[model samples]
Target: MTVIDSATENVAHTESEGGIISWVRPKRVDVDLVIPVYNEEEELDDSVRLLASYLLGRTNEFGAPVADGTRAAFTWNIVIADNASTDFTWAIAAKLCEDFPGFIRAIHLDEKGRGRALKTAWGQSQARVVAYMDVDLSTSLANLDDLILPLLGNQADLAIGSRLLPQSRIRRSIKREFISRSYNLLLRTYCQARFHDAQCGFKALRLETARKLLPLIQDDAWFFDTELLLLAQYQGLRLREIPVRWVEDAGSTVDIFDTAVKDLQGMARTRRTLNSLSSEGTGEKENARAKTGANATAKAGAGASANPAPALLPDFRGALIPRKLSYTV
Candidate 1:
């Protein structure tokens, strides 16, 4: 397989004990797939290696065939986002980076939230497209092409794997299936979301679109995926969903009841905020109309610009400047 030496060389590597590594903007990459993990010491190494191999092995679907000794049509980077794993996960991550020089890198976060891990990785990525999947191989690797192809092909701003799609093949308990369907039904009734699945771990986004929506998302736990999709739909971002083959991972750490409660709360809060913004926008338009009589042109412009909406989230890489972050291996 053609190695991504150029992109790998641009990254900083661990040199000595207690050494500090500063984040630098590296050469642009075509795709950066982030695997977020927490205390996954047993599974991290194998999963990452498998994923790296898969990404490197892919050939261009169309165009001239990729011959041996030539770089593939796309260059990819695998980012291991470790969210405060209390085990040897960090050490394993560091070793993987060392073993697969240009193919892999790992990030350590002080917090222990899945959303937090994703936020750090996605925000720091310099790749054209950013994506994340569960460390467990519950979803077949075969479906990966479908999940990322739309984003790479520029057919959609975001792509999500949907186990709820009619064509999806799933192997899971009846209890889990019912919970998933009921949760999605709640999302549709409360938030009016269009997508079939919201909580699927397999998802991708154009870097630009991710930068816009990441800050607005407030949930830093299991509710994160749902909140993200809801805001993206509310703001009118294009989203595409593909059927995926998924199997239940018995080792899943999710607490169904707790997660369900949190998800419901997150949905309610998001709907309230969106309604408030809509109201403010309407009020501005009405005032502008009252002030101007026959000057329809001026009124329209004033109404649109007046009472600018608040920033989606506090100060999360708020500016649209170049994406850069402190790098440590």
Candidate 2:
């Protein structure tokens, strides 16, 4: 459980000679687009380029034009969360950052896994709105406006692109489709989760809401989304699900059997954790015990004082702060 502080100051230093600008202090933005990658070198470049081009032509929902474009006004930053790729993914990402200036930036991590990468990137970024999508772009960049619109309008705390809803169009093998349907059915029945899709990788969240819930997620793999959704529901957050067009990429890395088993196990884990917490008053006693353990550990460190204050964990069960845990799984 590593705690990261993201509220650093933003300072900009300019070099007059070459029109170069460097961020001397941490820079915050309106939106942070987090793309967690494993071995997505094949389609990474095209996906990023497309997103950059689209972002450059949009508006910020204030009905004002952005960058002289005919579209609505919007400002965003794309953060590529590199998950220890073994190919040229990092190099290509670096090149894109170099070529695009402030529109794109790449953060590299030696650890590999979707959840690990996303957690690291989200913790590091300083955006009001934080989002992540699949590297394959299966959800299509065209629907990005729909996902962000709810957040912009304050109608939703989190918005997810759903592929199993009435308005969604999915092109895939019948077997794969059946597996998806079956998984969703199981999730609803066992987990009591209300969302149509709990596994779709295209999702956006307000940074405040995300900060409240992301730390509660325990799974660091494909089941990360499920844990997030379940925790959000437990906390009574407002999550909006919107249908979107999605296609199965030819070289997708999804393994039906393995992923299904893992997802089920994760679901059971979630059920158990929630049940335990509910039974013991949202596990407050357990949390206190954990804090005491942490304090003891901290005291054992070299040159450490015996009476250190217990670090405060973010409370996800608060009232006024709606924990919008919405997503298209």
Model 1, poorest ten-residue lDDT window?
320-329
Best candidate (score: lDDT): 1
- Model 2 is weakest, by summed lDDT over 10 consecutive residues, at 1-10
lDDT of 1 by residue, 2-59 (tens): 1223355644444432221222224677888889999999899977877665556533
| TM-score per model over all chains | 0.80, 0.75
- Looking at model 2, how many pairs of residues clash? 9
Q: Candidate 1: what lDDT?
A: 0.74
Question: What is the per-residue lDDT of model 2 for residues 203-313, given as tens digits with 9 covering 90 to 100?
Answer: 887887889988898988899888887787777677888888898887888787998999999988887786655645535645655666655664355323443322222
Cα-based lDDT at residue 2, candidate 1: 18
Task: List runs of model 1 lying over 4 Å from the truth.
Answer: 1-25, 58-73, 294-329
lDDT of each: 0.74, 0.71
Give the C-alpha miss distance for residue 276 in model 1, angstroms.
1.3
